[model samples]
Target: MAEPREIPEGPAHERVTVVLITWQRREEALVAVRRLLELPERPRVIVLDNASTDGTAQALREAHPRDSAGGRRLDVVVLPENQGAVARNTGVASATTPYVAFCDDDTWWDPGSLERAADLFDADERIAVLTARILVEPGGVEDGIVTELRESPVQGAPGLPGPALGSFLAGASVVRRSAFLQVGGFSRRLWLGGEEELLAADLAAAGWELCYVEDLQIHHQASVLRESTRRRRNGIRNTLWFTWLRRPLPAATRRTRDLLRSLPPDRTSALGVLDAVAGLPWLVRERKVLPPHAEARFAALEESQRTSKSRNYSR
Candidate 1:
């Protein structure tokens, strides 16, 4: 772990910007924005509305028109169309801050987490992203994914703030702006579900590290309004796509077979497989296996991933 910094005595607005991307769920998103604006960090926030027909853009704009001093408390960018996770790319591009904390409409950072994340980034240049501990709301219990992140089998560089990680959950992580841009942000081809894997791999390959910091925290309330079936389908499909795009032939083939074998016999699982097959041409064209070091990091996680309840493709 790195030594803590104690010279700060102010809001974290200048060093970190919160990026929230939402689609369709106007009410939930509005509530999220309001809660975020009330955070003590007072970080500038950018909300990306994915061309929602439910007037999410108008609602967010109306709810947070301006701050107490009439400065822009929130910047809402309404996309021309739904861009899935890609909406975050635009939000991050608009931020002037060096660090961008990716917050889903259903989640928000703890008051001091963003500030601490900025400190962690300042302490280590190799750290590309630091994923926070997530406590599911209503009871504030640890999320299942936290266990996987904490017990990650992949080793990280010594002196990192926490355990090293192969990938991060975007909604609960803070990323260095430069490293993220260097790798082209989130993948358009991946769109939304399970999209962080590819970006994490690219960051690792580019000599950046992703870590899971146990002390930094975020809160989440699973949105009932989310499209579960589509999320599952995309998560499954993207898993296949990423595996094929970066893993050697044998690992890719084994991963695909193992994934398919584990999936429930349902329409959603079938559609996910079909979608991955549909992208065969693109996958083949873009296939570039990671270098030995980066490849080894991901390979180390196969054992844990196979047994992870959090990684399961189910509602």
Candidate 2:
């Protein structure tokens, strides 16, 4: 067996577990797991397989037999049905760590990034999610969207360890376990793409702060087969759903109009908008607006949302 990476000693041996959500990308998932296993933090890892039919469960078990038994080991949870973000909730339930770092099947955390994230949570009481700097692969370039996070237009108090973020990138963030359970993990309805926004808003409403940690890093090598068009559709739909679910009526109406006007005059955007409106009956029944202060934060991010290259509704 290969010797594990050297981990930093902290206040005792606090475990930090990693939960990676995977679908059909078996090879990419294996590579990511390999890198994660090499992290200096030596996190207990779990791969949440969302009913993948491509032999992912078999591959994982075959590749890491010893990682499955005795000691603090890697566990693979295979769901019979596709539960989307709820798969993450199951993975979190299975983790025994005070912190859980989420990584996508195609992404990997830096050497000691998980430990640093765990340290931040250990030191702070108010911080719920510590979002990391995401760099794209091979050439190792900064994801352009990261620039927006770094120079976040949202105003926060001086005492904050990092910039206050309106939303988090799930694949590149470390979340405190207790806080995550308190606010509930990602939404089941939002499925995969851009699912973090609604949850972030809810976490803030519950008085937990989400911060951008510059020191921790996660690398994303976007997979070639990712269904980008469908992801775009879901992003648009989920954005609209979030707008209706929590924003005040006037704010929701205005935001909906703005989204409509800004969207391309094509069938895709049309379907996205229509899908959102189609769920209006439930949206109205479940509507719960944020308090004025929380609403203000959402309002403040509107202009950035309008201008961001990351806000595109198309792949």
Candidate 3:
């Protein structure tokens, strides 16, 4: 095997573990596992296969069986059914490391990124998450979300390493284990699409900070095999769910109205709105307004969220 890349600063293995979540996409998961295990930090990995029909879990277990990297530093957890983003909670539970670098099957962190993240976490006990700058594959150009993260208007504590963020991209972020578990890893109701917003809000409410880091990078080669319409539908529903679940009554109502008015006139939008409205009972039961400080942070991001090209709901 080739030499592992240099470990930049912190004790990476002790501080961080990579928790990769995948559903179907067997071949992509295989390649993702290989890249993760090769990281210079030599951090341990837990692959949570979300009950994929594509033989994803079995292929992963076969590829990295016991006695190699599999035994020494890898684990594969095959969920019995698709738990959506909550599937990641299981992986996070099993991680012994204090921090987890969350990965999607199509995304992987840079060699020294985990180490840098650990150093940041060590320096600030209040920091609960650090979302990295993402560069897409092939050409290695910045992802559209990078600009939003880099220019985040949310005010952070004095010692944060970069701009304060109202939300983070889970696949490209490192989160503190304690804070994540404290707020419940991800909402079971929201499932997969746009789930990070809820968790980020809760973490902020609990006095934890989240910020963007430019040097800590993750590379995403978005998978070609995806249901864009389904994802779009789910994302729209989750966005409405989160808004009503936490935002103040006025804010929630306004956001809901704005969202509905802006949605394209199509079956998908109608279906998504229906998805949101159908859960009125449970959503009403679980709704809790955000504390002033946390709500303020989100309020700060309103202008950017409204105008963002990357925040489009239409496919």
Candidate 4:
């Protein structure tokens, strides 16, 4: 196995901004932002509070302290209600920098991951997102999902940086601000769980590529408080929604069959099916099949998904 790459220290670009989304978990969010602030390059930081009720807003105010007094400039937006993945859309609009890196409250970039991602995007105009290899905290174990990402089946012409990815982990990737906004941010219907797929396909259709760089790394300490069953249901529902939205008829039918065959005969699968059925009207109206080349690229992922242990339909 390749040893982990060290983060580069020099400024890779003029300015890169970090957009972090948080809710309820005030303490974890503070730790992430503090680590980000300690990085040498001094990237700009913004926090989107998704109507956090656990004193998150007050904690941020006390921590920054001088946003109004010539201290570190931290932009904070408090939404009136919880917007889930849509919160990211609101936060990205507030970013003025050339590149934006998305970090969940429980994740933080390695010292120079942001700078290196900026450099990668600068080197290739067609690359929209540079997904970092995520390393789990404390244990230092590689994230289970990284294996599937590293071995992506998406076909790319010769000499690409890494496997051509259909989608990326939103928390572990650095994206071009303009390209991200151009394709439209995460979908509102999908909301939070595994929301990157739809936007990724749209970006690919718009002539953008997503790559995985083994050299880049982000540390993630999975949060303790989570709704696992609900997350699983949402992930399955969103998978179905994205499939119908972009896949050709035969490919979509095959995917549907695979999902049904693999899912356990339990309440979770039933809820997922119900959620997917509830959105059928909108899915039909909004469906725009991918062009031939893109369709082929997506079809390539089916084989990978079949063998991927990381894709288990559970929390």
Clash-forming residue pairs, model 3: none
Estimate the overall C-alpha local distance difference test score of candidate 2. 0.82
The digit string of per-residue lDDT tens for model 4 on 3-96 reads 2233233464345788899888999988998998887668778888999999987887788777556766567789898887778888789887
lDDT of 2 by residue, 1-315 (tens): 112224334531265789999999999998998898777667778999999999998898778777335554568889988777779999888887778899889899998788778777666677788899999998799999888889886655466678988888888998877788887788887887778988888888887788898999999999986877677777788899999999988888888877777787777787877878898898889788887756776888888887788766744
Q: Could you give candidate 3's per-residue lDDT for residues 151-266 as a string of tens digits?
A: 88999888789999899989999998878988889988898899999999999998899999999999999999887898889999999999989999988877887778778999
Clashes of 1: 0
Q: What stretches of model 1 exceed 4 Å from their correct place?
A: 1-11, 67-70
Q: Per-residue error at 75 for model 4, in Å?
A: 1.9
How close is each model in CA RMSD to the real structure? 3.1, 5.3, 5.3, 5.1
Which residue pairs of candidate 1 clash? none
Q: Kindly provide the TM-score of model 3 when superposed on the true structure, using C-alpha atoms.
A: 0.95
Q: Identify the runs in model 4 with alpha carbons over 4 angstroms from their true place.
A: 1-14, 67-69
Models ranked on lDDT: 1, 3, 4, 2
TM-score of 4: 0.93
**Could you estimate the TM-score for every candidate?**
0.95, 0.93, 0.95, 0.93
Candidate 4: what lDDT?
Answer: 0.83
Q: RMSD in angstroms, candidate 3? A: 5.3
lDDT of each: 0.89, 0.82, 0.89, 0.83
